[model samples]
Target: MTQQASLVALQERVAAVNDVLNATSVLTWDSRTMMPAGGAETRGHQIATLTRIARDLLLAPETERALEEAERAVLEFAEDSAERRMVQQTRHAVEHHKRVPASLIQERAALRTVAQAAWIEARSKSDFSIFSSFLAKTVELSRAYADCIGWNGHPYDAMVSIYELGETAASLKDLFKELRAGLLPILDDARSRPQPRSDFLFRDFPEEGQRAFGLSLAERLGYDFRRGRLDTTVHPFEVSFTRNDVRITTRYNRNYLPASVFGTAHETGHGLYEQGVDQAFTRTTLATDLVGLYAVGGTSFGAHESQSRLWENHIVRSRTFWQLHFPELQMHFPDQLGDVSAEEFYRAVTRVEPGFIRVEADELTYDLHIMLRVDIECALMDGSLAVNDLPEAWNAAIKRDLDLSVPNDAYGVLQDVHWSTGYIGSFPTYTIGNVMGAQLMETLRRQKPSLDASITAGEYSVLAEELRTKVWQHGRRFMRDELLERITGRRLDPAPYLAYLRSKYAA
Candidate 1:
């Protein structure tokens, strides 16, 4: 086929594949949000069948020929052509899927659906045992997955690369070591100092009021409700069918103010990234961050998480941010927050209390939660840790790191939704997000020194615009390292993040 014809063929095939994929996305979203309890098994099978179809379509013999032909033309015409990126995306998915059998891939998808429903039950009961069999199957499936794809000494290298491209067990260990050492002094100092007294945050601020305030915050921060939406979920997340249909979900705790507020802000960060991608890429394969294992590792989850962390921790938790929003918060619950000063609220929100929940952790100890998980995941990958012993190991790690005993498995090994669906090696990206978030902020401050003032004024257009221009619009056109360097003029550095934590938590 002529290269031009080949390029057209590849695009047509990818668009067809995306139709199956996007429909599957809508089903998955509905399953999570609106599907009836009795529909779980049938939905699992339906979603898996669609997943198999998409996988097979992507790896079709004709599609491969078209991609190969188009790739050559793309390189010859211009190395950075969008055509080249698309081929790279196609080739990555083809190669990864080729390693595993079609039936196994479908089974894994079905298993994930069942595991998620089981997790909700286990979490509600706060019983790890209730989730134990599902967890075991999840682990076994993960191992089978790694075994199918083949691995060197580190099976998790492939596992983590599923979410964070180009990252490996060795690289993360080194990064985590540096992070832990840097954070220790900050954590120690923050703990030694008296915490700000703002128990009013736990006052009875009705759920309806909290949700309304949270949605308003999301809208103010460029959420574009006409194009996107906010909803309730057990674990907050953002999902998108296309740029114009981004949806985010957050759970609420009426007695704990920060729960819904930060969760909404965090998911909004992700929504903004999705909504900001080049409109040209929407509804295409290059659109969703869920385009995992599709390329060598473009748009790392760490990079994506940085947007959520940046908005949730650095901006939303800052004193200046409260200067603009505290009144709105008080308006939501006057008796709960009317007398609370903005600085006091900021201090309360930013408080460095070490806790069991990773999502709700303070900035200082947030990464420490990731560190524990990284260690556990590594041990699981190496066969040093048993799946059944996870709760004991988790509790021990918590006690060692935070000096807190585990009261139950829900707050211990069963807290996160990642593992229920076989995302064992992905937890560390939250820490990576923290590091990258701070690094991005450092770069942003240099570019627009008045960015904080804009945030303080309840005018975040400047910050949103900067991130869109520098980071979001390109989507998978660049990998994580390439994106950071192109946006910040340097590679990832832990020093800035370390310094950021120290400055924020200094006694």
Candidate 2:
């Protein structure tokens, strides 16, 4: 076959796999959002069947043949070319999956929905016993998965690499060490100041007003509603079937105003990345996570988180954002925010308060929440911690890290849905996102001298276009570090993140 014909054949095979994965994503999104409680079991089986089908298709003889032909066809292409990278990535995923059994894949997929349902009930009842057995089974399957994939260091390393390639327990420890050192003093400085008047933030605001404001905020931040949407979920997340259909969900808290507002901004950031992917790569290997069996366009979980954190923190949380948009928000909730000023609202939202919830945490204490989760995940994977003892371990860590008492399992060990959903090693990505987002923003500000002015004027297209060119357009064509190095001339570093926090909080 000619090179073009060979490449086209491989693309067709990969696109089929992408379709199955996208179908799985659609079901997964439903299970989390609108599915009835009793549908969990059948949904689990359905997702498992689709996941197994996608895996089988990826490893079939036809796919192997096409991949071989594409490999030879793309041999003369540049190393960084999308054609070469697609073949290379597909081959890696094939090899990776071949080491694991189809039964194991099906089992893991089947457990996700059931376990998530159990987690919701347990959380609602503030009961860990209700979910402990499922969690134990999940940990066992995760261990088996790590063994199948083969790991030389901590078993958690294998899990971590599944989400963020090249990250391990040891490496994250080093990164967290540097971050903790820089953050502690800054936290102290911020805490010593007189706290902002945040009483207004806890006042009653209707869900209708919050949703209207969130929708406007998302649109203003460049989230394309034509190809995207917003909904409500227990945990906020963004999922994409392809670039053409991306959806985000955020929870609403009528008693706390920042929950929906910032949550919408964060998920909109994720939607923007998916919507920003090159249309030419749709349904191709460049737009699918072959290893994770998801039709996501971002290069990695951490890279995806970078966009969410960037929009959530750097832009939406800025003084300029509230100053420009606060009038609209006040118009929505004139009764609740009648006495509040824009500057006061900004200060209240950004106030550095160490909280029990990671999602609701302030910027200074957010990474501390991530570090605590990483430590517990490592212990769980290594068998140093027991499943039943999780609440105790979680409470101790929360007290030690955030200097707060745990009120219950719902507010402590059962807070996050990651474990139940089988995202064992994904927590670190939030902190990595913070660091990467700051680094990128620093580079962006240096390169675009008018960035602050544009932001102050509430014009986001300038910033959005720059990010689309630098970070989002390539999809999975580059690794996390490669994208960072290409944009900033360096790999992931904590200096910029620490500098940003220090400048914002201490200075």
Q: Per model, how many backbone clashes are there?
A: 0, 0
Clashing pairs in 1: none
Writing each residue's lDDT as its tens digit, candidate 1 over 301-382 gives: 7888999999998888887788777888888888888788888898888888888898888888888889889998888877
Off by over 4 Å in 1: 1-4, 288-298
lDDT of the candidates, in the order given: 0.82, 0.95
Model 2 Cα lDDT, one tens digit per residue, 1-507: 999999999999999999999999999999999999999999999999999999999999999999999999998999999999999999999999999999999999999999999999999999999999999999999999999998998999999998899999999999999999999999999999999999989989898899988898899889989998899999999999999999999999889989999999999999999999999999999999999888999999999999999999999988888898899999999988999999999999999999999998999999999999999999999999999998999999998988999998889999899999999999999999999999999999999999999999989999999999998999999999999999999999999999999988864
TM-score for each predicted model, relative to the true structure? 0.96, 0.99
| Residue 367, model 1: Cα distance from true site in angstroms | 0.5
